[model samples]
Target: MNFYNIVRVSVVAALLGTSCLPAAAVSPPPARTSAVTNEDERLLALFRDDQRREQAIDPLGMLYRTGKSDPALLRQVFTDNPVRALNKSVKLSLSALKKIDRAKLSPERQISYDVFLYDKTEEAFWLRPDMLALTQVTPLDHFGGLHIQFPSLMAKGSAVSYDNVADYEDALAVDRAFPFVLDNAVVRFRQGLDSGVVTSRLTTANMIAQIDGLLAQPIEDSPFYSPVRDFPDTVPMSERTRLQKAYFAAIRDEIYPAYRRLRAFLNDEYLPAAREQVGILGMKGGPGLYRHLIEQQTTLPLEPEAIYQLGLSEVARIQREMDVVRKEMGYGEGDLRSFFDTMRSDPKFHPKTKEELANGFSAVGHRVDELVPLFFNHVPRTKLLIQPYPAYREKYEAGGSYNQGAPDGSRPGIFFYNTYDLPSRFLTGIDTLYLHEGAPGHHFQISLAQENTALPDFQRFGGNNAYVEGWALYAETLGYEMGFYKDPMQHWGTLDDEMLRAMRLVVDTGIHFKGWTRDQAIDYMLSNSGMGRSDATAEVERYIAWPGQALGYKIGALTIQRLRKKAETELGPKFDIRAFHDQVLMSGALPLPILEAKIDRWIASQKG
Candidate 1:
């Protein structure tokens, strides 16, 4: 999953009751000339201007991407207010984009034009007043809520700089804004309460637990205080004392107090008012909102019922494959549930310690790196680190997640493995998980995009759930050709992971659209796969917190898989897997339709 997306995914999504915008032409355009060159330059210049203006308003976002933020802009905290500015920016950009004739540009420029238009038009829809009503009121959740991301952003391993005295003070300036962000969230929660559109009770409880964990940490151990605990050699000795004091003051006076206020509000006011039903379908504008999120997240015009049905079909097919794998593992003619039971109950399938888990993942990464050249022509130079989730955040996190590194390769991209409840975590999915979240998955897809200076900023940094997560899920299939899944247990692990994604399609749509209860979702996951109760519960809660997101993994992987099959069939033996991967990834993430178009164009070119 994209690190930056988690915090904002709950608050923003596609506009309800709207069809997708018509795509820009993807076929080869006329030959380039002085006129076309001028248009391309003008169009690119407009994109750059929009990015700069956006960065000006969102200094933290700018800092995350570029590792630099203006001191004057550091005080601007992230909030819902930017949606309005983004709406206006999209309108102006689209107007300017329409004036350029897409057919006059070269094919390369045409792809950029299509992606840019799709992105802005999609934003225009979501930023509408009606759409914002469904999102803005319910601001945070346990999964990707700002409460979780803020600390993670401030932690040592994250992407920002802490090189000198000025850097320390710039962080302080940003740290001061935490309280206001929390206050604004409370205001939004109150709005949700007034309108009877609050978050789910389960999610509210999860957020409360998460906040309580944060508040329980001592002042010195707080992630916000981490920066000053260890001073760099560049800082003068006299300044170190003051910096340490200021950092502690920020955490004590500003940060912890804000967290306590949020905790109290959630415990006292919001939790009671929060809905008992986990699904959004029970809320006032829920049905429309779920539809909007489904479209927004998957980048497809799929009805929830359609997704639910597709999920059912996928689950049955995967279970059949699981049955075959079960027989291969020396279990004779037993039901799939029995095999699942053994996998879950057998202590041998789990990690002995967190270090053991970390070592296992590191080994997988090393092996994958050795074979990287066999499939991918482009390998990211950005370092990938494997570490367990920090104590404060692990209980609520997923099995694993990837944080992007600096484009300049200063900080390494990290894949956080959840070692919470160590005995409950399985060793079965270790290699597949490593492939999905580490090398050639998020690390590859994200690092490659950002490292390529030749692409436009949007193509390099901007992304959608369908392409980003889908590419990662697709990356998991690469394990087969690489021979990682040769062991029957390992293959079962891959199937189990695949089953989780397939079940997400059913369960996510089931909860939000069909009103499946939280327990109901958990029971379904446990019955279908070897997932333990703890992992199953966490996955269900995640879907409850962020509906329609899990749907993208299976849907996206299927799309990429289908496109690859089409390319292979058409190109015959001439097809190069490396080139196919390059075509899919070289332009960064694209909407599924745009990606399909690009692949079709590549297929045609190869045929000639």
Candidate 2:
């Protein structure tokens, strides 16, 4: 998933609440003729242009801070007013979609549409006002805050100031637009289900239960309450405290209760009804849908068995490397599984305190920045910050995560370290994690994408999972070539991480497609890699929660590796890795096929 969708996916199941804005007095319209004067036209034109620009960029900021499940608010912003000119733009988009040949569209775009079309309930849930408020509202003013340009336009239409109206209207518009998108999505979803491409009835039932639970919550008890308030983090000290109290009140009253309802529903109404059978093969046209997902994700037209086999080969290759590391660590004849246990239990690897863990991550961030110049000439102007994960989310966050800043530079890219379990936090692979999630990995690629004004909004601030995750994985290896992994243990940590991802290719498919139990997947990871039990358990649950996502890292990394090797061989001695990297970053993120096409063009130009 791209960054925008990531926020939507994460938050769709959560409850949120917002205070009602004071009603605005009706405003007199500016003098108008059948045709507006040039100056008036210019003003409206400028406003419309600004609105579209903000709309495009808004999703990026929204995804980072909140999840993306709200479509109702999106529809309102794009199409709420019957007389609004922006509604014309929505019509224009529909027209464009109709005019284009579905088959002729790029595979990535097609998959995007197909996914959207098949999942009406999800589309509706994503566009809901609460969902939009949860995902889009933030402390940053320019992007989600009141001072932003689009807010100014909305305020002009209403009597409220830009700041007050922006949040409410943006939220309202998204809620309105959500159902329309879901209507289209349901059509596609049924087709996929019938065809046997997406046969996970259990997953669907769980998702539905989650949504039902969210809907049951009272708005006052939502986790999203703080974010939806007028000045999320900037209320006067007294007001801030009030807001915080209200936020928790809402979480307890609305959000948690909703989650419990859904959880109970899943257990009572859905789980038992789920099927025991696996794979898309039983669906009428299952092979085709599976083909489409593979094509969309890998950007290749390989069959499921071929993709599965490719995963198997990669797993074997990474295990061999892990064995080499094991022997070097002097664990002769000790199976890889035992080594993983030793690494997990070793007190020497654990952090003494949360502060120490945060500082250790900060140090890794600095070290990565130092080596960045060695590998590439072009570097992002964006700043990076290493912070502990917010207290509310530390328990569930990945080991480390990168939240990219706004395209307009309102926020700095943040690398949030999860320090909930200190024993699980260690020096074992901190450097690799930093490189993968922070400097020269997500931060670099994402910031550069936001900085590129030349690319379309979708190409610039948006991305494919394969490209985003793949590039991050590739960044990990660069640490070695740039001389940052001087310590043998650190180097081994990098390989261990890589091995973990490769193993995912096997385990993800194993669980969802092959019916392997959760324990079996955890056991496989324990036997193959030196990860802590808590960490391994978390990773396994993540795959269970999100199928197919684990495959993206290995698939993406290997694709880039193949591309780099091809570039080196084709360019011979003249090939400069720095220049090649610049070319890659300059285009921002694209579908792998598009990236490959661009690289081929770059190579051809260099030859001439």
Candidate 2 displacement at residue 115 in angstroms: 17
RMSD of each: 4.1, 10.8
lDDT of 2 by residue, 1-608 (tens): 12321221211211111110111111222245544344433333332343353344233234332322134333332222411332343344433344434465343344333322222222243345433332222111111111111111121111112134244444334333433423323333333333333324534453554344334545543224424444533334455555446445545654355445534544464345434443433334434433444444454555555556776787688778767877887677778777777778888767778887777788877777777776888777777888776554455446877766656555577777778788876576888888888878888888887765544344454455677888988999888887767676777788888888888777766775666776888898877777877778777766654446567777888888888898899999879999989877776565677677767877887878
RMSD (Cα, Å) of model 1: 4.1
Writing each residue's lDDT as its tens digit, candidate 1 over 1-608 gives 56423232212221121222111111122344554577787777777766755654555556565555554443323354556666677788998898888877767788889989988887787778876677777767888777777777766557457889988887777777767767778877887798888889999999999888898899889888888888889999999999999989888998899998999999999998889989989878898888988988888999988898999999999999989888988887668898888888889899888888988898999999999999999999899888888889888878888888876677888888999998788998999999999989999988898787766777776778888889988999999999999888889899999999999999999899989999999999999999988889999998898888888889999999999999999999989999999999999789999999999999999999
Each model's lDDT: 0.80, 0.54
The clash count for each model shown is 0, 37
How much RMSD separates candidate 2 from the native structure?
10.8
